[model samples]
Target chain A: MDYTKQIQEIATRLFAEDKIDVFVGYRLTGFDDNQVPALIRESKDVPLLVFNQKSVFNLSNYLKNDHTRNKRVGLVVKGCDSRSLNLLLTESQVKREKLYVVGIACEGVVDDAGQKMQNCLECMVPAAVVYDELLGEANMERRFIINADIQDMAAKELVQRREYFEEVFENCIRCNACRHSCPLCYCAKCCIDQETATLYNGANTTSSAFHALMTWSLHLAGRCVDCRNCEKACPSHLPLHLFHKWNERVIYENFQEHLAGVHEGDRGAFYKYSMQDPDDFIM
Target chain B: METVTNQLVSIEKPEIVAPPDWQPVIIGILCNWCSYAGSDLTGTSRLQYPPNIRIIRVPCSSRVDTWFLIKSLQTTADGVLVSGCHPGDCHYISGNYFARRRFLVTKKLLNFVGFHENRIQFSWVSAAEGPKFAKVVSKVTEDIKKLGPLHLYKKENFEK
Candidate 1:
């Protein structure tokens, strides 16, 4: 992880050469052990780039946002973050030529509590799958594991399972933090917004909460990079991964062990064609 | 525990059941080219279906965004049925295809968050199939009734 000097040097070079209009990275917050996503537009701001366990938020989320969209940008991405960036490229959300990606051979980033995230712990690609520059020492590739929560959910009876998820949906406040925090949720006028949806009366009821959460999750099914940003952003602390992990498991099992954004050109599971895909589920 | 005590009280003083007078409200979003016309045909042929369903016609099934579905659940509706043209037969060519992809993901997410999957339905009904449209509506109504009212988020509102 001791790539601080290297990161600073790269930032300086990008600014000096004017190769990028902005450099999006992480900087340590003044009052806490956590790091916040930083946007550096000038050469003087290059010193703000730092790498440590506290640098948690995926920088890729900012790329699809208004601030960075259509701009020549330099971005730092960890193992998990890189996959998301790769997906953005594959989906044509951003142009590859416009980006100067500084790839990190991540040795796992820790959460605010200094604990490793589940996805980081089981991360198979500890380096950027698609980047213009590489950083840190490459680690051995690991195996992807089905998250434990999803495994436990699979064992529940139909009624019991329904009850378990019902409790989770009950806590949603309809703030759409999960959707906003998500990099994939870039729709200009999201359907769930109050003014746009005539059907949803825009009230914060349990039924509405259930519908909103479900719709958001499904929207990200194959595209989600397991960044867990949505889960972290959710004020209710809902186990959003249960939905994602379940979809991931099914996609993996049915679609030739497909992983979203693992390769630069890899299309999503639904977007691709295969003679071997499971036909039993389709009517 | 407080939970145990509450359960015991509920068991000791059982709530009496009322007669089955509850009629579920179903919100159906029909694609203008196919499902909407199918419902129109049901009216023309005088084929009787449950009056519980209220239809909204959209230009294409893809226009039925996730927000509309959420809004339906929050309103008076007990179930949502999004009916479109068969795959590859959409009036906009690939509108139904996009809807199919979206619906699959939405269904999985809903199931994950604990909403009963039976409460929402996505189907393909051609403009010529009036009987099929009626049958689908009736079937969806029955399915939602078996699950009862969506009280997962509504119980707290009632408690206040």
Candidate 2:
């Protein structure tokens, strides 16, 4: 997309105006067709800002980190990233006034294989819902599609479902790469860290791996934006989205089609209460 | 005389036997205001339960961070049990409410990454339910034993 030129132009202007202390975006990693997250502090660094099919990382993860905290930041957000930003604002994780968001009317970003991500393919919002300046021609909202894995999981017998998940847990290495890559996983010391988690040693055993991965996923349930960054960053190529999608599906069907971070001030599903929420599942 | 000496030497030698195979370890974090007292009552009544569980007492269920659960799973425990007061009965008025929300979200994530939901247990136990505490521990112990040593993520030390 010619949006790369627009992004660079904006970065230059932000630097010239001295309005932003740092601009977080993406650049080529120089090893392959993959794009890595780039933080531009100088105006001269604007040339490095390139948006292409390989720019896969969700840069909003940096917004919650200490490095960017309290600093006036100019960030580049695709449709999905912008939604996460919205959630951050609602959660009080980040202040809106401190941010100068460059929103993109995204023409869906590509995966490592250069194919459109399933979330993007089923994208309901192709334009940044909350940005200071918007780019690209906004596409119409599409219908939300239930993830294929969740459907297949629902079809399986209980015993078969257990076996299927057993195989998935068997592949985890317990590196915490998924946590590290996630913007919401900003705990100073993670629960999976060995010294702090004395009861659950960080031994990387299969059980340990299983526990670590699952716990990390649970922490992100309602808050996860289905950005697919964790799944993409994972070395074992685990289907991380199924966890988020299943929760998303449940929230969508049960709640008021609640999408995390769609609006600037919307609270999360669990945070808001309704007298009609189903309690049949609870004894 | 030589035969006598050989007999003595053979008699002095100790037999070498293998240690028992590693048993699945499960750590249960029971809130003091509810589940811990329940566990203590189970002990006072001499209720028979599996010895697999090692319980840690916490003031409230909310104090048990997700990191504590993760770390327990990472280290020695095969499964984790987080038992607290039933909703609305929480000693802090709303500690268990926050816990319930946290557990629901955590359970979803653990299942997503392929951990069998069976490995993590969340329940509500009041101080008066001593038998129930024993039952919960016994059930978790039996379930973990059948699952065998948690091997989905290999212990780094076990590697050559």
Candidate 3:
């Protein structure tokens, strides 16, 4: 799963050909095996770029940042990262013509503990769906595995479920780290932050967390790429993936087995509706 | 200086001791073209119904953001009724269809986070279905009454 030398060559070539102004990849933190996202602006720093299982941060998140916005970008993409990139392209947040994407057929990425991420273990798309130079063996198969937490929650009593989530929300610090880490949360002014916390209900901890999480999940209902950027960014380590995965399951069953940003020009499940959409939930 | 804000947040809502006459507060959000007009018909036709609902009008069902429901439960309303035009009956073509997708997800999402599934509801009422609108409101009000008040996160507020 190591493509360090290959990525460096492509990045060096892209810079040499004057095709990209910035190359977004992963670099060693100068101390650990784990890599931090590197935004390389000069060809001399192309050696800094690395691609491996430890490259956990989704580089596409930087596409919306000021450094790369409206600039030519040569970047790397794994399966999940490409999906997020696909969404950004569809949403018109980033133009396709202004970038050169080096795709990777990811096996899986590991966390600090060297364990494969939960989302990767259940990944359906294992290849870079959109890339200019793919880096690994591309295998796209649907691994429709329902997460244990969501299934277990479904089997539990409503009271127990509520009690569990109450703790989850109560622990929230409202630092807005999850929002900043989400690439799709690209609104010039975020809708959630537009209103003061006081304007919501009160500036209480659990209430604000509940409001923020619910609002954030709904905003990303169909478009989330399951990259775990928000989960990684949360200081409290909230099980944020549950919200997105739950919505994904519901949408998959009810809305014609739709997966977000899978096909080109796919406007997400919420944007377009089918006449066959379930109306039984309505009274 | 916090006008129209956080007063709901500061109310440390106590447990519901249902008095013999404590009617549940139901917030009814209706789309202008269909459900709103249907409620108007309910009034004009002298239809007798429970007066528990507080109606708010929106241009279309899709205009109702997900936060509106979350805020309603966290603050004042015991229950919410979001009614829109039936499929293919939308005044703005397919507004309700898009809204319908969101409504289902929002309902399930809220339920997943701990609220009873019945606390938030949805229906499609055409402009001609005045009686149907009355029936829906009564059903929603009844469901909320049984579920009691939304007692989650009604703690004391703080200055952010």
Q: For residues A1-283, what per-residue lDDT tens digits would candidate 1 score against the true structure?
A: 7677888999999888989999999887878767889998999988878887677788888997778989999999887788888887877888989999999888887776778877787666777777788886655577566466665665554456667876776677778888888877877778677575543335566666666666666667677788888888888888887777777765565456778888778877666544454432222
Model 3: per-residue Cα lDDT at residue A67: 97
Q: Give Cα-based local distance difference scores for all models.
A: 0.74, 0.73, 0.85
Looking at model 3, the pairs that clash are: none
lDDT of 2 by residue, B1-160 (tens): 0111011111111112313685668999999999999999999999998888988999999888776776676567788889999777889987876666566555544544344566778888899999998888888877676655654443443444
lDDT digits (tens) for residues A1-283 of candidate 2 = 6567889999999889999999999987888767788889999989988887566778889997777899999998988888888887877788889999988877777876778878887776677888999887666565556466666665554445556776776787777788888877777777667585543454555565665666666666567888888998899998878767777766665555667777767766666644444433222
Top candidate by TM-score? 3
Candidate 3 C-alpha lDDT tens digits along A1-283: 9999999999999989999999999999999898999999999999888888999999899998889989999989999899989998988889999999999999899999999988998888889889988887776566766566677666676677778998999888888899999988888887766755564443647877888888999999999988999999999999999899888878887888888987878977899999998898797
- Pick by DockQ: which candidate is best? 3
Q: How many residue pairs clash per model? A: 5, 19, 0
Best candidate, lDDT = 3
Which digits, one per residue and each the tens of the lDDT, describe model 3 over residues B53-153?
99999999999998888888777888899999989999999999899999988988887777777888999999999999999998888777776667786
Considering just the first chain, candidate 1 attains a TM-score of: 0.93
Those runs of model 2 whose alpha carbons end farther than 4 Å from true positions after fitting are A27-34, A41-48, A52-54, A64-71, A90-95, A137-139, A157-175, A194-203, A247-258, A265-283, B1-29, B34-56, B66-82, B108-160
Query: Could you give the C-alpha RMSD of every candidate to the true structure, in order shown?
Result: 6.5, 12.4, 6.3
Off by over 4 Å in 3: A195-197, A200-204, B1-17, B155-160
Lowest summed lDDT across 10 adjacent residues in model 1 chain A is found at A274-283
| I-RMSD for candidate 1 | 9.7
- Give model 3's TM-score for chain A to 2 decimal places: 0.96
| Residue B118 in model 2: lDDT | 66
